[model samples]
Target: MIYTELYITEEPSEAMNYHHEVRQVQSASKKKILHETPIRSQDIFKTLPDQQRPIRVVLTYGVAGVGKTFLVQKFTLDWAEGLENQDISAVILLSFRELNLVRNQQYSLLELLIFFHPTLHRVTAEKLIVCKLLFILDGLDESRFLLDFTNSKLVSDVTQKSTISELLSNLIEGNLLPSALIWITSRPAAVHQIAPTCLDRMTEVRGFTDAQKEEYFRRRFRNKELSSRIISHLKTSRSLYIMCGIPVYCWITATVLEHMLTTEESAELPKTLTDMYSHFLLVQTKKKQKYHEGQEMRRIELTRTDREVLLKLGRLAFEHLQKKNILFYQEDLEQCGLDVTEASVYSGVCTEIFKRESVIFQKPVYCFVHLSIQEFLAAIYMFHCYTNRKTEVLQEFFTEDDKGNKISLEDISSLEDFLSRAVEEYLLIPNSHLELFVRFLNGLSMKSNQRLLGGLLGQTESSPEIIQRVINKLKVISCQGKCPDRCINILHCLLENNDLSVLQEMQDFLKSDNKSETELSGIQCSALAYILQMSEEVLDELDLAKYKTSEDGRWRLVPAIVNFRKARLHDVFVFGGSIGSLAIALTANPSHLTELHLSSVSLGEYAEDLFTHLGHPNCRLETLRSVN
Candidate 1:
């Protein structure tokens, strides 16, 4: 496996390399860890303190897809290669997901060792235990075994017969092998399965830092220039860059970029999570086509079959995601119109699109490669049903199955009504996954995306009228809510449509609502910035004091606000928000503002920073006031 020291914590500025300014910003935000010493993956057990009750067990926790498994693999490989942790004679890797299948089977530790490691059959359980051993247990959250320590009898000897869970419990609790080393990996949600005293040290896999993200990309692409370009493009979207913190997402992103850059020049790069994953899905589908003969026939046949598989997979993803399941049994596959054999095929074609693996007794369990993929598939599934005019699918998306199945949009007289109902019925719930669903819905509404989908899923009407209605609905939603971020995202999706109607509508909405104050979310600010940049007319004055915003919102508005010919605030009251935009405007070359007025405003702790910029040499402020 390709390896890099792509994970680190910033202790001193001297210890890292990236960009100086980036390092400074990173160092300032992170607190100093004074007590915890840095431990390498291979040396994790070796560094544990030797005490009366030694720290023989290590618990490593992280969010899903944060490279915990990868780290384990790397560590294990290093040991096997005699590169690190050489003192440990052998390492046994076990997956809880696989372990679940053997929960019903009674086995002694000796028998279990033979099951997972057949080569070790010659060694007796007692001898294997006494030898230098490192046991790695992966994915505690996926395990179905009832690990009830309170009721289970504990045995220190290897010949003791017990259920799979009891075997694991005994191993971790030191009843089976007190001198042996154990490393367990789990998502944060499943960390409580082991008692606090059972493990010695608990470390979290923090994924990648900014510098590490850069390092990974650099290592991933041999073409340094192309890597730089990709990194630059990724940085343009904060949310997209944030997703790259996960190693799997980073790989997915790299996959998308490599496909787009090398394969097609005209193709647009992904800017959002939905777009990125959708592109990834397309890439995965196309990848299968490359191996087959008869390019045209293969493409069509594979595309058609892939679409069918994806639809069923999407339904499965949505249903399981709703149930908060990242892992599912073979029975779950049958429920979603997929048998184990068919799922195995998809697992190969998708290649981490949907994973199929066997558990403890060789019982198959399946899961989407990652949670985000599940969300993406779910979104795609919902849209599939919506486009197909399946009313029950709408109910499924909303998780309101009991509300009846006869529901249809036919009675919703207008497009606006249908959109409003869709938003209210589903998007308003604020499920984290729903955000991606709405984004995909909005993106799939685009004619270009629809064309792309059409190629793979057969033709469907790509209606500009429907797209406009959604844009209009989003604008309405943005102005009506306390946090208008999702609504803003919907509008952002339509930005490439080259339609300024949404922006004009937003401007009109802001201007017309002079009677009351309205706040724009961070995304709303981005939308406003986008509109301002796109607008041809150079206004003499612009004001946003009536609309309260946050630091992120203001920061996004900086470039747009600074370009205005004259910015004004006669009686507008700024809330506890950063005025960084205004400050940046003040410091710009030619500094467009001719006059400024602040009657009553609180610019938070960064108020002085804003004021200091006003005194800059390039400041064009003809008049200024800070009224008490």
Candidate 2:
């Protein structure tokens, strides 16, 4: 067993910490990911410096591609090599994706362990009781079983036979393996499957810190100058830098940048997220054709077969993305007109790229190398639908028919409205889940990106007037007070369109003498919040009322309060759904806030949690003034 360490942090067990660590469903901005506390991987099972209880049944979660599985692998390998956690006699690692295969089968806890780990076949139930076992169940989000923690039949004995869910429930709840240490890994959305009372500690894997992000690029390229240029260019685009916190995004960026710079195509380097992913797709395809097929590469071109094959994969990406299902089956591939065996050809971007992007597990389960790559491909397919006018597909997506046929975007008003409805139309949809997809969809509208994917997208209209209309529609939606997830994504959409006018306008308003005369829009408030959160210079004061803006604008600025020393939110109120961002601000580590004035403001249902922050470990508020 070989192992290597990664620079990472284990967030505090408090729900507030998890809330801030994973601010939205996708992830908090890169600024917040860097603000967390760093804890080594081996120390995850040990109690924190501030804690008293022995850590057991740890629920560690992070967003997709944040490297939760990699950390688990490293921890297990280190244990096997006798370098860490010597007290534990054995480690049993299982993935929920593998567990999904046997979801319908019944087995005793002992049999389950033996099935996954054949060496455990000789171990009896009595032996299990004596061994210090650490059961690491990975990828709870990918599990297909209904994890009913409340009513599942509890089995105290490891030999007792039961359904997989029941056995899992009892083991996780400490009924079956009371002496065993349980470690469950999941995406943040699925952590709710285990109630708060069922776990001892909750730690979030908050991706790479700033230094590690730089370390990744430097390690990738032998040339120091190339690495420096890559880092410098990433810093120029806030969106790219923020996304680079994820290791997978960093790799994708490196792949795109290395090829462009080395090929003397530095002038054609990608700046936006859409541009990067598009070039990534084409570049990977070009490499596979040249190296794997023994073809001479002279020009970057998407042949008709290449277009058909990539779109099939893209369609698969889009359909499954709607369900938030990362793993797929053979049937899923065939349904999209994709040939299973033929998919291995274009292994660079997907299907078989180093067997990383399109992964086939021990079973028939398949998935993209990363969630964002799946999203990028999905966006391409959806954009193809728009360009080709696939009404039947769009109709299926716009409404739910009894037939269960899913579709794509409809009406195709301004792409923002179309994209806006993509998030809001499905009321049951979690807005954050669709953010990356929508961002990619909007990014595809860029002229530069369109040129790159022109073959697939087929030369869509890219006029400045068309872009302004989309930008204006986004502002109207932001002002109408959409959910913070959707609103922030709207601002991201503007950034994807290269619409920096609002950001510049906010900067001008901030520097103006008669600021009271200048009124900021909701989108501008969002831009302001983003700037303040990412700024190196902390503001001495953040008084929302002083800014001339609508109620939605005020709501958008609440997230930036953590970046200021004194916050005056007098007569202000946070919307119910948006209040979580405020909670995050108050509890952010290295807190700058010393005084918070909420005079005449009402937190209402959230008042209890907000007030409880006064004693939280990260809360540094010294003065709090509020009426009613």
Candidate 3:
């Protein structure tokens, strides 16, 4: 009953305010029109001449909780009134979420068109096709058709691009449907791989501008006193304001303020995103407690695994909260340890409060109605997961050394018995342990200890394998100097172990003349310095001329110098000699070389003279260091 009333609201402010909390409709269509124009008069309304020609489709996409659907609704309602005299036949607003419930089989576009209107005869449908019907497809990224819930797959095997493309193709090529102007909305990731031909124009719906935020705040709070207070609160709350780029965050913040005023609680308002969400979650918990009471409460009754899953989801939400982006797929969920055959971990939690009038925006592939809820959940998760016990457990698993002893594979397997089981359990229940595992491995790779590196790389489990696979995948790409700084440490580990296979693989990675060149150069310089000690012939095979010059004719020697100097040893003169040649070449023509590194070089009298020449202002070397 609560949800039914809320679903019928016409006033934007009233509908959004109490829709989720109380679900009460305040105005009818007639009253809403008289009170305020449902559609803005100044909005653009361009008419197409014919319905037979292929109509241009433009799509706008962003994250969930960013007021995308609301914007579309507002635009359509306004457009219909503004273009009342135009020959527009009808405007159909179809949500992918609604369509998913009725879709059991792979129905064609014609079948879907007919299915939505069973009363219309075939002749009427044909005539309607000739008339210009504006088709607004909302939430393409959330389309259930693209999701494999039963199999934990995100992308469809058909490889026809997006559902919109397939639908458009059916209508245009098959001649089953009319050439209608199609406007779509989806999250960024959903439409990322979609081909350019699918849509005529693609615009991104950015978060509310500051002016829009001010307008929204004024619209929500009629009382000048309350409005001023709220504005002050928002201004002081930097993180909350950043989160407010999405309009839904504004609504959530208003809701919190409204509740605070009603309860006569003038408690300190949250200043940061973490604090804001923490407050929201605490409020949610308190509200749940009032209804269920103690042990029987659904919030309190959540399993440890369930709680962990929620926390992981929360952490992800917190990280991307400022961007107001949601609508991620199973692969995205997998990164957080929630990849499984069952409904997503967050959706499952939503299911527990099914009777509540919560405005849940669901699509099969992605979930979450508001960015605030995601942030709230993420903040709670981070708070608990970073506790001392979990930290220690993560530290031991990632930091402990596993020397390459002659232990049997079976014994090693038994020792790591928890890994497969943990992964399996996480797969079934959906938790943040996998994300924690990845973060831990990432952190460990940054450490100077070879033992920690060996421990992480020695693992045979799927989780650890993913880490290696990621590294291997990264190796193939062009390094844009943006490759993780921690990767240098890993390369150092491989060099110290004399792992020629990894060294060769790294060398092959550096040879690719793609976007990752600068990164590969640094890795190469480090690996090659060590390799040169064993065989200077490898240096003869490298082509160093490519990375020598920037676009402005200035020489860039940071990558080469850093790696070469870091690997230098006091007694290793051969390594120093080979590096000196590369450094000398880098410093020769460049007049801006500020940092010079002969750090690990066992410099002879000749190398010292070379260092002095390189240190000159005309030579452009500012800080020069020679170990010996």
Candidate 4:
């Protein structure tokens, strides 16, 4: 029996941050239905390897940035050090992202092994297969070629030539080296490509537990005091804290906060995903200065080269994201005006932000370190394009309408024309990449952000007049339309601009008779949370009694509700919707609503908890009304 200790980077108990609920399917439940279950990532391999029918093929799935690769890396490192899985003589690790190169190339199992693990080239196939081997295949979703099992010609010989898919299918199906073990990692989307029958055991990476998040912060920052402060600040915003579940987001946070904390640049830290990502980009840009001691020299030479590379990468990122392509080949770089030499230089200089990976038997591919970063860069590209050419870029890049026709010249003159087009054409759809891109566009307008971009591009191109026009258009559109997330992004953009007029516009929109009975979507709730954070006056209390709100919608409002200083509801609306969110929001933040008016409202079963929160000493509620 072989076992791998999680190490946890600290004492086991110390890593336990209360009881964190992991959302996954129970191992005992044969059906694939995911539910919240309390399970530790460390305890995954605790059970012994069964002698009779050992679980040889394990499939672990997770969302991007949830630490799947990190877990695999840790496991491999531990095994190599002889601390765990000693029964396995060798661990052959391969990334499908890299394996994509050899998809068409014929190779025997022995050749494929040696191709990735060149040290085994001299070892005879018979001797290698006889020894215990564990194959860890990572990033199955990154495979360029479809793993078409139905069409693949399967072969069992270790030295026989076959398609990569055929070899992989045969290996997993026990057609070749039946005794060998396999471990596969994939994002959730690609998990179904492998037949259910092939998986001996399935596990999902749930990212950092609360305790693990704390432990990570402690390990990341040398100053314990700063780490504690960062943690405390992050905990205050539910959305920010939730994002920390992704290890990469946590790293981004640490990177941004660490720099901000040390520089004394600004007291306010990024609270939203857009702000955080914008800060990340700025941090990367500033990093080049360290190489040059004189600030003047760094400023001049840095921007010229950095700007060119960024523009090219941003173009590539934007185009790829539009096509839902995260991975790219050499031609993609050239298409974006980057040659191999320039791209390589950029990759080395921006290693923290960009990555270049060699695909065996194929040309190397390039991509931003994270998908979110690509989206951010894409957004930046859109903004830069807009700044340089105004309506021309939108006409060329966004619309397919003929240039001679000139459909709406008057509409194109408005500074926010790009925002309008993005919302109407893209962001209204579910899971739109433009959602984040638009937010990045907003964040880029900030003066401090402008300074960073100005340093890069020689000068920031946007003006306050243009930003004000965009905000005005956003407010008008958000009020008239049904897309809450778009409305929120508009608000987020306004916030980045630091314009208070949008707050009044929002207040006006909420107060409008026509807009009074609108239900807030989850995205709208998030948007409201951003708005409420910066507001001195609460947006006229939402009277959603006439609105159609689902249970999920109420939960979405929790983040927004917790930001309220005083809320006056006209009916038992929130309770009738989702009592859980109401209770959680109020309990989470005692001073949330100091003067809550539930006029003609019925408490029903939620009365006890609602009253309990109101009675808490920290609560500042001085007025409570229920006039039926």
Candidate 5:
């Protein structure tokens, strides 16, 4: 009965754009659509009100574009509107992608809380900790980076290890704050590390059912006189219907059909998704013609080759959008083996064809006003980017290693160079490869080996500089910037000795005029905290607990705790000594335990004793983990 009206976007302007479109839809629908199926989520929604169960966490997963967000919004809005009492304090809907800018920052959680509840006080924040708020976090996979937080930076000798699973464990187990009814939505790959214990229920968004899809199609054609020829074509298009289960794809298909029908061109109906989109773009271009002569002349001049180039560029741009890359590069185009000179001719054709239908970046990057168009372009690319010829090109870009015939370092370096070049060229096409390149960067960063970071940083000796470069590159890719732990670990490699000067540099950088200062500062602080905890010596000088608290007073490390608990440690030692010694020292004098990370400390062998001691009624330890 209620539709949550939160429109997720990068900026306020974008949000306004989505808001306007949604408003138009609302105005068109005078009555609610009939409830075709029983509300499957009602039972789940009801549990949120059960004080005894105290439903603090719920996870909903669905295929992309299946309307998971829509359902969640609808449920939350309905609940809010129906409330007779104000006991349901607030309903906050957050898109993880939008919060990425503050990722890995000390006050990120605080920033998010304030962004949603500007009037919330420190006391209210604490009270809400136990289940007073309904927080819906959508699109976890959209986050820019995956972080591991159990590692230490103070010591130069061994690497620190952490995982997302560990972090979730700590949050639920620590019971440091009151829990809230939290809902998370993600694609399957995003929740691989989610602890089973943290989840109360899981729902999959299966897109529109067959009946819904039929109803949707019927609604579009109810008033229009349909030709038997088109109806027959539609009846045969099973794959098209399946794809159209997603609303955006349905819109694209409908637009294509409408154009074909108006032009009396039923014979030209597309048989495949790519052809459908191609036809759509071509028709869209023709609609802008001032006269028949101009339209005919332009259509005659634009060859299939030109269309291919435009479609390829569109696909690359779509990838960039997916990766959240905002910057386009010239080399990205070249990597596709598309000559700039030829691409320029195609660009000219697209300009004449689409006219005001699309927006062209200053440097020739063509961007569709609707993201659906980009999605259409990407679908086309996936169908064609890999061919026998392209496969050969990839092979030529790499050399086999002598050991096990694996890809050599030289080959990896070459691939990176090739990707970089491709990214540069794609950028020149005006918003072309920006999104695709960003996705590439995200995939590269998510690699387990850290080789990508090393390559990106090059030989830079300055740890802060390296971190800054990584952050800057990530921003270019439009990553959510939520994973500070990875950046902190990278910093550890460069700052082996707990160098005070490096710490000072990090502090100075945080204060400087950088876009990612907040996120970098968070990463630096976490790294510092990790180091201090690892080396009992440094923990004595600084107050680590202060950094853990934001001005708003909400806990900053809930997510971090979840991550620390899911990590695996091999031959790992905590505090350079046995777990008992470290615990005794930390509990004996709290000030001396500024940083306390015991992740992967073989704690299972002494779990009962450690928990008995660390979990004691009078324990003074602020932070300690058995696995990261």
Candidate 6:
């Protein structure tokens, strides 16, 4: 709940669904935020002095957990306290999760306001028309109503009765409340629902900047030493550092690290995402057990009833995650055998994994602390299902058509095939919501994580043979995959399994004089590309022809040259189409190549084909050597 300022910009992000964005944003941890204009919460409803019309409807989009909801809440609080937006007479902030529950109900606009806020019951319809009101509708991504802008009935009267969907659509379209300000928040996937013609401005919320991340821990903890230790530990791992952009992730890190630093336990500090989350889960459970059950537990232990609730919650997480449904209802809870009054719903100390939103209505709403937690729980449940021999649950899931491909759950008896197929299924789609979940799944397969959650996960084993198979399957998938995103994900899976063989071989090949002993595979070249791009140091020379790989494998290494000062591409093919690896590097914003040594490589069929990037503003090429 420590509110820090997020990087809000005028330029909207082009990310897909939430988890697809979670994976993609790591690439930007090293790049500059390409926002054309930065804005504050107060500036969202303001019109510029460029002789433009008044900005009425503002559609704000951001990735999940980027602090969109918190920003709006703070904005409302500021307005209520007369600190900002003093001109506005009233600000009514309604949660979309709560609103989604009553999507089918019919109500007058005034009645709708009174339903959510009973204090507004005294304010008559006569007082509403004269006052300047700002209606902040949060979480359009979780909305259930299909807003038919073209077909929904228009209701201009605030007293007129209509479905909630029509009332919102009409209000946004300016038929109901032309003078009132409308502010809506949505994830990138649902931003297209509100057309450009209806919106006057668009804003995107980015996660914590590098400076803001440090400031957050300092603000959260009074002890400077504790904050410094936490920050130092996070910087050691690239994944942990990049993921700190999300405010919730920052909280998760604070919870796990602070517990370890302060406690008397001699557990090793977590280095991976799975390790952090696994420790986090156990920590929360231990606190709950010790407080509620009256006995302090050791390193890691879960009671029988605790394991039952976890598996039930995991089932809920698994079921909704596949449907991309973050928000859950009372029925969702009951379906998973979770009673509203049960100890599992004990909101006192165990709210991190699952909790409910405030509602005086008959129906109760539920959600995990974050999408990542939901994904973590979902991964645990899926693994549980596999280990418990609940093939029916997984079979029902894999039969559906995902994105464009039909995913078949056949011949996946082995642990390697089971995980590889899941990764392959998600990779076929442009934006895989399961990207983070699959990463968790791979990480949970490790002996360390399995030992922590053994009671709940049944008896899933990761023998040396199984681990090698998973690693081998990941490398093979990377070579066959067409999308660079998928190939990068394959590498991530390798990292999750604690297998650094590909990277070690690449380093070995670099150091060895007799490099002919072993040739780098296409996936290994891709892995080398990842290592080069992520490295803090710059390379002086990169000779693609020196490393022995196939023709396609040579192109796979093109992204690595972005770090090189002098790149030697002798007899290399730089062309368009799916083999657009050179295009990927040359168009790189921070390309640092000062000299090029392409002795016999093709520049392209035309000057503007691929070599035109040499004239780009970001390009720093000063020397060219082509003896051919």
**Candidate achieving the largest lDDT:** 6
lDDT of 3 by residue, 182-211 (tens): 666776445633444444544445456566
Question: For each candidate, how many residue pairs have backbone atoms clashing (under 3 Å)?
Answer: 3, 4, 10, 2, 51, 0
Deviation from truth (RMSD, Å), model 5 = 22.8
Q: Rank the candidates by lDDT, best first.
A: 6, 2, 1, 4, 3, 5
Query: What digit string (tens of lDDT, one per residue) describes model 5 on residues 318-349?
Result: 45655643223345556554565654524453
Please list the residue runs of candidate 3 whose C-alpha ends up more than 4 Å from where it truly belongs after superposition: 1-55, 79-85, 99-104, 119-125, 144-165, 172-178, 258-266, 288-367, 375-628
lDDT digits (tens) for residues 502-587 of candidate 4? 45554655567875466555435445444554354444454434444543343333335444655645443343212233553353
- Model 2: per-residue Cα lDDT over 252-314, one tens digit each: 899888877876453467778788888787677666564535343333476677778778888
Per-residue CA lDDT of model 1 for 1-628, tens digit only, reads 4332222221111111111121122222232333345566766665444445455888886666777888899998888888888878788988877776676888998888888888888988658766989889998877776577788787788988888988888888888887789988876556767787676677756667778889889999999988998999999875577666677878899998987887765667877665676677767767665543523211223445666777788889878766667788878878888766764445545675877776555676778877778877776676677666666666555443123344445643343444445554443443333444455555655566555554433345557776676666555443222222223444544553334565665577556745236666655665776556435454566555545676545544443554576654434223212223465456533346677666554555657666666556556677776775
Indicate whether candidate 3 or candidate 6 has the larger TM-score: 6
Residue 608 displacement in candidate 3 (angstroms): 41
Give the total clashing residue pairs for model 5: 51
Q: What CA RMSD would you report for each candidate?
A: 11.5, 4.6, 19.0, 11.3, 22.8, 5.8
- Model 5 residue 260 CA deviation in Å: 0.7
Collision pairs in model 4: 17-211, 594-621
Global Cα lDDT for candidate 1: 0.62
Off by over 4 Å in 6: 1-15, 33-35, 49-51, 122-127, 291-299, 347-349, 400-410, 478-482, 504-520, 528-628
Per-candidate TM-scores read 0.66, 0.86, 0.45, 0.67, 0.44, 0.81
Note the Cα lDDT for every prediction shown.
0.62, 0.71, 0.41, 0.61, 0.40, 0.75
**Among all windows of ten consecutive residues in candidate 5, which has the lowest summed lDDT?**
9-18
| Model 4 collision count | 2
lDDT of 6 by residue, 18-74 (tens): 226665456446655443356778777876666379889988776778888888988
Q: Candidate 6, overall lDDT?
A: 0.75
What are the runs in model 4 whose C-alpha is more than 4 Å off? Answer: 1-53, 122-131, 265-267, 290-302, 342-344, 347-349, 357-365, 390-397, 400-412, 428-431, 455-469, 475-628
Model 3 poorest ten-residue lDDT run: 1-10
How high a TM-score does candidate 1 get?
A: 0.66
Q: Once model 6 is optimally superposed onto the true structure by TM-score, how far is the C-alpha of residue 343 displaced, in angstroms?
A: 3.1
